[model samples]
Target: MNKDIYFEDVNIGDSIPTLVKEPVTKLQFVKYAGASGDFNPLHTDDDIGKMAGIGGVIAHGMLIMGFVGQAVTNWIPKKNLKKLNVRFAGMTKPGDTISVTGKVVDKNAENNIITCEVFAKDQNEQVKIQGSFEAKLPKKN
Candidate 1:
């Protein structure tokens, strides 16, 4: 929302600003559970996670998706987002640092829309989520 990004200024391979999230933490999972009403013990209780054979508590997929959403909205205004979709690719554990990135994949000059391929990867280069989005940008005057 800082400035309008005109469609004419962006190329098919242009990179969007990256968003880096703080390390994942137990407290964040608890907070997300409270906010999202996803009280699944696998995300909140280590013992339950261990019992379920996951080794330890895992971060909620939706929470990671929220991080990806933040990345999208940080580059384009939320109101201009026409489509945003993601596939949960892997589990995120506490202390994992996530970075969200995107590249322009396609565009529609007539409709002023830009399509982007987006993803969230950890410090170790493990992909946690992969997705794409479409946003409407202003036409150059």
Candidate 2:
């Protein structure tokens, strides 16, 4: 079970625990396609990808966003999240190692909310997705 993160325990600039995912794989993409019902060829068909201009199959943007979401919920319980958003900045291909990191950017003690700036980057430090989130936290007694 996830413990409640008290608002008093977090400070601006505090780093959230990082979540590093294993390298992207074709099988994962296929599974994601089935699970999401997004049968886009660019995500599951390499030959189609080559024809479309991208060199090979690319992972779905939502899949990468899911990774970012995991990073947030890992630190803040799912029920606490009030807002979560991301922008896809780059394509993620098979073999790319994704690392998600975040830092506390703002905290409203009166509102019991914490805002964070979060991003996902590949092995080369190329950002694939960037976003922010707000979560309600308990107050320490």
Candidate 3:
């Protein structure tokens, strides 16, 4: 899908298209917990979440990070990417819509790599994840 992107075709400040994800829910948290082997009650039990200071169960921060990763990979093929990192900044509730976006931050031609900065936001425009990505672009003939 990213066959169109070549090393010489991208530049700093170029905006990658946005990727939208479905809302988070309790079931999703439970499933993710089981899938990831992370059974932290704070992410699946409302009572424990409230007692921990957060009013309700919060989605796993890694899940939001995954969404951001999905955005970058969606724009550029997987093997093209070499590095990606995300920081969970805000809590996501059941009804929140997550949108992931990124921009070309720098190009490292000597190493055949391009760097990108990414973030995930909710419907309120509040940033939920702050992240960065680095990728290897195909060389031009």
Task: Note the Cα lDDT for every prediction shown.
Answer: 0.94, 0.94, 0.88
Better of 1 and 3 by TM-score: 1
lDDT of 3 by residue, 1-141 (tens): 665689898989999999988887899999989988888898999999899988989988888887887788788999888988888899998789999988998998798899989989999999999989999888878
Residue 119 shift from truth in candidate 1, angstroms: 0.6
Error of 2 at 7 (Å): 0.2
Q: What is the TM-score of each predicted model, taking all chains together?
A: 0.97, 0.97, 0.94
lDDT of 2 by residue, 1-141 (tens): 577789999999999999999999999999999999999999999999999999989999999999998989888999999999899999999999999999999999789999999999999999999999999998877
Error of 1 at 10 (Å): 1.0
Q: Clashes in model 3: which pairs?
A: none
**What is the Å distance of residue 138 in model 2 from its true position?**
0.5
Which structure is stronger by lDDT: 2 or 3? 2
- Among all windows of 10 consecutive residues in model 3, the one with the lowest summed lDDT is 1-10
Off-target runs (Cα >4 Å) in candidate 2 are none
Residue-wise C-alpha lDDT for candidate 1, range 1-141, written one tens digit per residue? 657778888899999999999999999999999999999999999999999998999999999999989988888888889999999999999999999999999999889999999999999999999999999998768
What's model 3's lDDT at 94? 79
Against the true structure, candidate 3 reaches a TM-score of: 0.94
